[model samples]
Target: MIPAGSGGRNRPIEHASFYAALPLIDDFERLSDTANFTALPEDWLIGVSDIEGSTAEIAKGRYKAVNMVGAAVISAQMNAMDGQPFPFVFGGDGATFAIWPEQARAAADAMRAVQRWALDEYGITLRAALVPVRDIRAAGLRIAVARYRVSDGVDYAMFHGGGASWAEQALKDGIYGFDPAPSGVRPDLTGLSCRWAPQSARNDMILSLVVVPVPGASARLYAQVAAEIVTLAQTLDRGGHPVPRDGPAMQWPPEGVALEARAQRRSGTLLRQRAGILFQTFMAWLLTRTGWTVGGFDARRYNRAVAGNSDFRKWDDGLKMTLDCDNETSKRIEALLAHYHDRGILRYGLHRQDSAIMTCIVPSIMRNDHIHFVDGAAGGYTAAATAMKVQG
Candidate 1:
């Protein structure tokens, strides 16, 4: 959910202009229809953050930390906007956000903050980069975008074309790195958390996948693959959505986790980190139990909102999903994907794990909404991405 304005009148002037300048689609159903998306403005800026060596980190049993840091990049940028509207998509290992030219500085600062946080707190390198939209176009690539209305006060951006991918590659190639914030300059990681236990595989396995159309692939073919994924999700996963939405409920004296390492704030010291965890644990109990009203906070309603805002399957330049299905179903899906891959229609990566992990951001859940992001617990998007690279 977008935060409320940083201030009534002091909110950045570019906020309104940037959102007003774009074309938005209110219908989520139409997102699958390729005709609905439009080319992004040439004057905008594309910013991205991806954790280097994410697969290794996941292998080290730090998947939760990886997921948390990845989501933190998006959360940090959203907070920087101070309630302004922008287009962003969460990747399993990082996030990509687009901003108006006027907001580039703020966006850059936010990225730097997240980069510093990732390195200092998680001991992972978060590489962030920003490139001009025009430069991308000059390289013969485009950023196509559309907005999907999920629920009241919740909207997500869908991206098409290969521009975002190209930009990410540039970052990886050391062509677009941003100057990070000063040492100890932490990003506002206030809303990040991982409160739920890992979700067990429903039938046999949870498949972490990334499917990208081959270079020069026709839009019609890509759309066909996209539609097929939706059909498979419905036909296989008991129609419960490819991404499940089971999180901690609003119970009193909420269950506390033995380890809070994955959900600590990055702005504080060791003592403060422990204190922050205790405070959040206590707050979870107090807020959900007593139903205490503070700053328009309502734990019960927030819990409901959390369940509603699950982002299990996301679309950016390609499709990324954490699907819950048995072995047979997964094989069938893979066969279809392989059929397409062999035809040079698309490239894909598939990895299986026994559970799914979630990271969340609940900023005033009563006001806006709470969103939970899920990925396969072991390997997940990172491993899937690795497999996809090898396939390519």
Candidate 2:
């Protein structure tokens, strides 16, 4: 007899099966209104990719490069699936995704390729690891999933299980695969970009935060604190939103040409690829400036949507947010969060910065579903991770 969580053609270990099991959320505007997520399939696996010494790299003012490698993980995995939808979240210095066992090998291979590419092309060491859901469950942890439609074509994954957090701990403890990929393998980071300049905070400061439930802490209390943080973020500048509504003005070839060159280094001849990108960027910039009709689509509106709909906050095993707030508001929020920390109910890290940076995956300029990953301009998630380590 086939074992539980087993798959046949109808139950192929793909995202569709998992999504099919979920009740779809048609309301895109009310993301926080969703109910608790359901348990994930035991036959699936969790894939993670993180940069070693990412904090140090960020300190060296290579935060953009760090963000680029992080996004590369998701990009590679998406390519591995050949347009299949899956549950994934992009951390500033890494990324985590749930994949079916059937596609685990492809996912693993893609991660390894990115690892190699990061080391060779950017001198960054990337750690790619995979843990089975069964193992996570055996460790007394669980992973639950929910789908939140962020826009007409974009849906974000909301993970409820602490399994993801436990898996990350396992990887850090050297429990799973942490070795380098074979030589000559390169990650396909198609459409990944760090083109925009750092977004100046309309508020006096932008806050980056990471919050985890402390041992013996009430889950309910932890969730309440998390919700409070989101509520505070909703009262920020720029339409009371965490992300900016206006897109960064794009120069002819964009500001970070070196980053663009590194991203497309694997595409073809470096010079030719760079030139092609420059030409495409010029055309896009011209269209947005002149309000020229491109296939009957509004170029200017698309640019704003890319910024306004970015993935700036996430809740995996822990709660993370990048909030744009004034100094007074930031202090008040910190004091509120500190009360929970003082009570030993949660472990959190908060960093203040003057601006936030974004890395994007624009599969198509016309697509409203493009994803932008945001982080504080200085250290962002790396700083939060550092503070948490100190607390531990």
Candidate 3:
């Protein structure tokens, strides 16, 4: 059982709607402001999941599969929680989420199910850990959360303090880790899809970035750096959104059809699932090509929402973004980061590619609020994170 408090600190009053109760900040730049964050209840648990050896997987050109597995963690947990609002952030190689202790069993089942599914479907190992917020506090780190409203109907969680990063390290170091479920366990990955084709960079390049303050660096310094970087990115077209306003182009056979088939294969055989996916995608492609609305489903409107709902920028203990920009803009952003790196203020990594990909969790296409996670096509956050480690 997880403790309610640690180190003589009083347990926080439990708010059933703790996450929903926090005010939403509309401005992305304001994320750097620590004042906007709320301390999570000590009894809440932080769950971290990541693809083991994700960097090597990216080198093998399996980035799409890598991304699919990461997004699966969120989709499974959300389905398990029955859409009750909670907070989660999607990293290209994995994801992190927080949950109340009451939901621990469901969250754990979902995590184990995803771990097994990833291995069974794609030969990938997903490492997961559920660490208590009290444990994080005991380690002298904090878990502060803020909600950033991306659109009228969608808000992504932004994490502050180093607890999240610490949880990931602990998972990697074999602490607080758990084993995958027995064979044949399947996560309820309803609505997880990767049907859209990769969006080619409209500008000269698609840049993937990871910027984190060095250990013991003051929060004020990190916030100033983050704000400056956000400002620089804002100067780009559509704020460096890789997807076009109309959404990504739809090819007849999407590059992710097979992966989506695997995700949808809960009850049906793989062959049946693949065939169904093929037929459905065929209709979607035709509708998108013809610009038609059938059964109250507008392909154009859905596509527009896809563009607007993409998680192209977010903060998770640090700043992470996938931007489409010209060469000069990329150079300028890097130079600024290099100046800070030279001064030992931070550590950063960047990867440039020609296009970006979107992995989605669409509960309902008619809802106009489905979310899409974006990452650089060749090597997104996983590669950038590896580069950051290499610089040390």
Candidate 4:
């Protein structure tokens, strides 16, 4: 969610103007409709960040930390821009975003800060890069973007044209990238947190899926496949939202308390940050458990907002989703994906787990617009991606 007043009103009109001018698409299914996406300006830059060995980290039961660091990239850039509007998509282990030329320096600095923080705090190496849209075009690709409004004051970006995927590949190939800052450096991870316990799957399984068209596949075929999957998911409750209607269960001394403390450590000593987070979360746990409202913060309303504003599904040059469904529905999705995979129309990956995890950026608890990112508690997109690579 773009923070209010951070729409670049004080900057040059050209800065982030393209994303700001586009009309928000209310239906998630329309994300597959090519008519809704607008080509991004050639001068804009795409920033990508990911942990170097995310799969290994997840295997070590550190998926929460991996998700936190991935979301930190978006958080840092948002804070750096002072909450200005931009288009970004959060992958389970990484994130991709676009910014105009005027914000490149700030974006780069923020990226560097996150890189350092990830290494120092979690011993994870974060790879980051900034690729120009013109360079993407030079490589025979384009970046097209559309905003999908998930709730009031909350919109998640849907990407098409494959530019984001190419930029990520370029980053991995050691092109157009930068190194991490020295030890002790940290980004402004002001609102990043993973407070709620993992949401157990009510439907027997939490399925993480990623589907992408092959290099020569027709766009029509890909869109048809994506639309069909979206339709299939719609048959389930709340389109397969993993979190319950009231929200995921809250626990005292949250699972990610240490991570949350690290995120806020810039404000004071680590111990102090940890203590502060503990106090705040304890209060939240007590309030949510008792269904109480205190001075603009309605526990029940905020919980519902958390579930409503989550990013369970998104398009980033391809379709990705974390769904809660029974084994039968999961089989139907796999069958559909397999039918197309055999014909070379698309390739896909699916991973199943008992629960899903959420990482949030709450600019203010009193505001219902806070955004949450969801992924399967076990491996999520990183494992799905690995499985996809094996398909080839």
Candidate 5:
């Protein structure tokens, strides 16, 4: 949803390059096999992880990308076992394998252990966080197992944690990994359901979430979230933000977002932080006004928040990114739109975490540069429609 050229013909050359010079990372591709994205694992504890700031973290620190990946791999295998006797697999950065659930817990414990090792061992600023399919916990992380069946594949539970993911999002923000995507795809975040708030971004009723669904349990919650998007479109249409609806195909803009099958303003960004930060910031601001601050965030509170925050929490789930996405690729494209917009002037192209062709893009929106827009998104977009303005 671009403003059609922040600097039209009247803009200068450098201003014109503001977008043209925008850095673009490799296209993010998530889920390829025509097989349905399901979960079918037999007595396997799946730990999903990805090297977040491996590039920068390595450059600034001593750890390399491979080191980070290896750490995640080792951690996944450890957590899956949970000290039990079973086999395990570390599916790269976004995932890992475990021999037993007991070993899996060990992996989660290693989150702090590994980071401490990185910091102490190699002078690297790396962190690891793990989760379990059942009974998972970490100091400041969200843990959930998404149970899904992929096409003919058996059921498998994907362990989701927050620290590494948050780091991944951060690394992505340092670059522009999301761009060049058409606004038709919508990815299902239900797989990444159990959520938590970043200690740095905590505010009122909102907690930064990891957001991986319990695999098969995302249907109702997904639908519930979709409802919130509908209401949002109605509100935007009334607010004069050009809700260009194309047709009966995609549910964007409610009426004017999709023009003849083309998305009017492409949206969706890895700027989960941008949206997260913006809204969370507002939450902090609002709650502060009313004496509200994030509580301890019990496990049940975290799970329920992901499933039933209504609009309050549901809205934070990045629902619009799924506007017209009927499959995975399209969803990536739409998500790219968000990835781009949220990046703002300082684009951050963070490729989809699970894409085969991994890449990242982030533009630096200097703090000293944009005074009025400091609280805005990274690139130049803001997903917080109501949060900032609703500060009563």
Candidate 6:
């Protein structure tokens, strides 16, 4: 007997034999069926994502940037999904997905990847609204689909919303995904987006809420707006920041180049120059060893993506961003925060004080404050495997 939730051609035949009583439909039937009332399975992965702060980003009339971010995220999502029996709706400011229950976690993870891609690539924050199949349905869809019966375990193309056209009418009535207002949180990307917190949010899909368009803005400009939005992305949603120190780092290779030059000139700027190299080295080490892979980052093919300088770090050394930060460090911290501001991670904050690292991938959680990682569970950091005794 074929078990439930099996995929890749082994699903239908097994499901057919198991749930004989529940009318089964073939992939073709499910796809072409004109009926609406389809009894879905216990598991459902309803995924959705939106721009968190678009209004301010688009202030410079950079709609293309917004679309670029959206395109990247959606394309990434499509790749992650790899064709499931669900529907994807590009609802202007945001998107929605209706999928099988088993794929909820996978969908959530994919959505997160998409958001991170937007952040690391275009410096935008994508708010995700993931839910199960059984929760939060458009009344229109419910009314439209309640008439037909569907076969379980069969592949089907079941999408309801698409683009501006489908959502045009619904958007006006405030029924696209969910209401954006009333939460008191205004999005950087305003109009043409919304989200709602579904009531059945806990029944399935690991128990969560639907993160629809809950007041945000979109990327309007592309080139010039890049720096502006980049700063906002960091300031608004960003948290942990890299702490820096004064004087050349303790690990600069070409001591003569920076140090000798500093000694000769007796200038703090020269020492600062050496610090930049150390910072770059640290970033390189972390990228290679750690799992934190940069999206728009390319050392070999380093283009304007990581930096406007496609010409081999031609940009000002001081403008370069540094990560793998420390808090005790001050000068470097200020420099790093300046970099974050330039990248749209930090807003109008003062001198570097804390880490800019975020707590979770979720934008809302990240906005509160610094999500510094601690060693004990009492804090955000990890807990000791087991309690220890005092040496005395």
Query: Cα lDDT of all candidates, in order?
Result: 0.74, 0.76, 0.88, 0.90, 0.26, 0.30
What range of 10 consecutive residues in model 3 has the weakest lDDT sum? 1-10
Pitting candidate 3 against candidate 6, the one with the higher TM-score is: 3
Residue-by-residue lDDT tens digits, candidate 5, 1-392: 01122323233444223222322211111111112122222322333334444444423532223223333334323233222222222221223333233344444444444444334323444333333323222234332223222212112223333322343443334421222112233221111110111111111111111122222343444334334334333332221111112201111122211111111112454344234434533453344345543564232222222221111111111221212112333344335434333433111112111101110100111111100000111110112222222321
Q: In what order do the candidates fall by TM-score, top score first?
A: 4, 3, 2, 1, 6, 5
Clash statistics: count for each candidate: 0, 0, 0, 1, 107, 53
lDDT of 4 by residue, 1-392 (tens): 48446356466786656677889899999989888999998888999987898989988999999999999999998898876789999998999999998899989999999999999889999999999999999989878999999889699988899899999999998987889977777799888988989999999899999999888888998899999999999989999988898888888889898889888887568889888889999888888888887886878788888988999999988999999988888999999999999999999999999999999998889877689999999999999999999987
Q: Which tens-of-lDDT digit does each residue in 1-392 have in candidate 2? A: 00012233343645456754565554432333325577788888999777888988987989888988898889888766766677888888898898887788788889888888899888999887989999999988878877765556666777765788888778777788656688877777777877776777777887888887786688777777777777776666642345556566566667666676777677577788778778777777888889897777787888778766677777767777777778887887788878989998888888888888888877766666678888888898889878887976
Q: Can you give the TM-score per candidate against the true fold?
A: 0.87, 0.91, 0.95, 0.98, 0.26, 0.30
**1-392 per-residue lDDT for model 1 (tens digits):** 35335442354455445554455565443566768777887888888888899888887988878888889888888778766767888888898888877677888888998888778767889999888889899999878887765556576777888899999999999999976688878787667776666777768888888998888887788778777876777676444343434334333222223224434544445667666666776786677677786777676667656655677776788888777887777887899999999988899999998887777776754565667777888888889989999988
Candidate 4, lDDT over the whole model = 0.90
Model 1: clashing residue pairs? Answer: none
Between 1 and 2, whose lDDT is larger?
2
Which scores greater on lDDT, model 1 or model 5? 1
Q: Give each prediction's root-mean-square deviation over alpha carbons.
A: 3.4, 4.3, 4.7, 1.2, 23.7, 23.5
Off by over 4 Å in 1: 1-29, 237-268, 282-300
Candidate 4 — which pairs collide? Answer: 6-84
Cα error, residue 241 of model 1, in Å, equals 3.5
| Better candidate by TM-score, 1 or 4 | 4
Candidate 1 lDDT for residue 284: 62
